[model samples]
Target: DADRNGFVMGEGAAVLVLEDLEHARARGADVYCEISGYATFGNAYHMTGLTKEGLEMARAIDTALDMAELDGSAIDYVNAHGSGTQQNDRHETAAVKRSLGAHAYATPMSSIKSMVGHSLGAIGSIELAACVLAMSHQVVPPTANYTTPDPECDL
Candidate 1:
């Protein structure tokens, strides 16, 4: 719940410790994994809504993979911001499949939105936390209220 009554706002913060592979190894730091690459893009079509084609989003994922020198098949998990909204879910699925091709279906993925609702600005970090927790526990969080699955969202 919000601390004040103006609007229901969720808030939190996260910090990650990162270093070069060799540096981490030399220190004997237990590394969870490496952040190979990342890409960001805006949906010019709409400020609050993502484009249905997901062309821009797909390109962003592709660019990240390319920069990481990794193939789509190498991805074991995808931490999607599954907002449970029609457009967002559909577009994200399309973008992922476009970037990962057939490997997208085989890879396990999940969204924390269903469990905690949208936390606005903190959503990304919360979702990342869910991913980290999943990795640590070796279990995927259930997509609560996910009934009558949409075929378009194969993941």
Candidate 2:
């Protein structure tokens, strides 16, 4: 479990079959959803540390939303990068709130790592699969090991 202090390292692999909507539709492919937006930014502050205010992360998220032409209120779910470390959990929650404001609390966010354990660099693909599965099954996968809420991560 990843909720204790740090994540349990694990090994896994996932492959997402993506195609252009027109090509998929022509071939009768089952399209899940579209990747409407993407953005990236480097903090360059630390290899193992994040900014205290999480402004850089928030900026990246904001950029994504702007690219998608969507507002925070339009967000339905948040698939968080919850590494299960004290610093990461707190910082991620705070960053979401900073980016999405009151809508952050309205959105149901969860961490797949809590259930499947962390797979390091492979996590993003796995988490995206989790999101697609949740959408397909209409379920919000529980944060498996979560129990008490920390004051620092009051999301």
Candidate 3:
């Protein structure tokens, strides 16, 4: 309980090859899939604390979905950037619900950090790999070490 804020530190790196569908097809390269859209933004709310409602992260998710020309219902799984921090976990769950509305409850969301620990910024690349693997296998990886869901993180 005391270590709820603690995270396991890990070391790793991942390199992704991104190419346009037409370009990959023209070159006869085996394409994993096309990245339809993406978005990024910084929350000026606080250094260590998030805003009360996690609106900024929700905005990022909404923007990404808008860019992809997809609705929240289209999303089947969410590869969360779960760092094993209680605050972050709750905030992220709130953000997902805010952005996806009702779809958030139906969609499966998981954090890979529980398995490999927190890699800091490098976790993004590793998570991307996990996403690809999930896609290839058509399975959603479970949140390791998770017993009971926190009421604060209903999503």
Candidate 4:
């Protein structure tokens, strides 16, 4: 049997099927929410350390919102790239707050990295999968090992 808490590196592959709104409608398929926008950014400041200022991340969020023609307040859920590392967690919190302002406190955010260890190259897709699961269940996954909350990083 696979140990649930044991730490072991593993590898796998997965695929997803996506259809445009018009295509799905024409096929009489039920829609599971639309993916309005997506954006990616690199932490060039440090290999492992994320910038505390979060300018790049904030810009990325803004670009995504603009592309989708939706304001930050319209985002019901934010699937954070929660890497569980100190810098990542703090920076992500700051980024969200900077982008969403007062709404950040009201919005639900989570990181699947707590349930599953960071999967380097596949992190983005894995995170998206967790987001879909959360949206479907209407439940946000808790941030595991969050015993002590950092005051500066409170969401």
Candidate 5:
């Protein structure tokens, strides 16, 4: 687990169709889920690297939770932006813990990038698709290829 280096430049694409809940119901469309909250942030800490403390990511998470009208305890799972780098993993763990408190430990968080590699533009859609599938099947995907857990990235 600690041997993480970097992600491969994978290639893929994904598409998600979002519509109003009322519109979906009126059209008799099967709605997978609704987006209750969303947030994004960046501190310009680095071009491609995140801050060591991951405060930026933590703030985003906390804000989204607040917008969703829920607390950390309401989270059943987490979709991480894990890039298979030491810094990314460690800081992400800290960020989740910071925003979610102890609930972060109990939550199932994983990065689809582990299995699909870093698809760059498409990885976001791919992982979101995975999350939808996870919810549909009521199963959590594992961080594939990982053996021993890293203490730093406890999530």
Candidate 6:
């Protein structure tokens, strides 16, 4: 499993509803969790390649955490964008360790790309839905089929 290659392309669709806290409460709706924070940036270095330095992704993580007024220690889980490529795995690992620092070692991170295949535009929503379910159930999903440890992608 550690011997990575590429993601399995998939076709699917998912939808998630976003509701304000007060509005949901007013309607007696089930609130999953707060949206907290998110960040996005352009990796202009390459069209399809990412830097092993992971500076871009790390900065995005830092910005999101800052916006949420939370630190890496507050994170309970990480839904990694694990694309199964060697570069993606190492890059993601590096970014997480940089942004999360010591907490990265404690946080549980996984990717459902193997299970659901990489659904491209739909994968993000699907994964976000998984996060909400995980929060509701108080469970974190594991990286599927992982047997050997690739020290490069540790944590």
Candidate 6 versus the native: TM-score?
Answer: 0.96
Q: Following a full C-alpha superposition, what root-mean-square deviation does model 2 have from the true structure?
A: 1.7
lDDT per residue (tens digit) for residues 36-137 in model 2:
988887778888788667787788889999999998888889888888888777778878899899999889998888888889889889899889989888
lDDT pick, better of 4 and 6: 6
Q: Write candidate 1's Cα lDDT for 68-135 as tens digits.
A: 99989988888876766677777889999999999999988876665666768777777776677788
Deviation in Å, model 5, residue 70 alpha carbon: 0.9
| lDDT on C-alpha atoms for all candidate structures | 0.76, 0.84, 0.82, 0.73, 0.87, 0.88
User: Is candidate 1 or 5 superior in lDDT?
Assistant: 5
The TM-scores of all predictions, comma-separated, are 0.82, 0.94, 0.92, 0.83, 0.95, 0.96
Per-residue lDDT of model 5, residues 1-155, tens digit only: 77888887888998999999999999999898888998998887787787768799899999998999999999999998889888888878889999999998899998888888898878888988889999999998878888877888887
Could you give the C-alpha RMSD of every candidate to the true structure, in order shown? 5.2, 1.7, 1.8, 4.8, 1.0, 1.0
Best of the two (3, 5) by TM-score: 5
- After superposing candidate 1, which stretches have Cα over 4 Å from the reference? 1-11
lDDT of 4 at 150: 65
- Report the Cα lDDT for residue 15, model 6: 85
* lDDT by residue for model 4 (1-155), tens: 11123222324444556888899999998776688886877766877666887777988998889889988899898887766556666677888998899999999876666667666777666667667777888888876666666676677
TM-score of 2: 0.94
TM-score-wise, the better of 2 and 4 is 2
Question: In model 4, what are the clashing residue pairs, if there are any?
Answer: none
Model 5 ranges with Cα > 4 A deviation: none
Instruction: Give me the runs in candidate 3 sitting further than 4 Å from their true place.
Output: 1-3
Off by over 4 Å in 2: 1-3
lDDT of 3: 0.82
**Candidate scoring better on lDDT of 3 and 5:** 5
Better of 3 and 6 by lDDT: 6
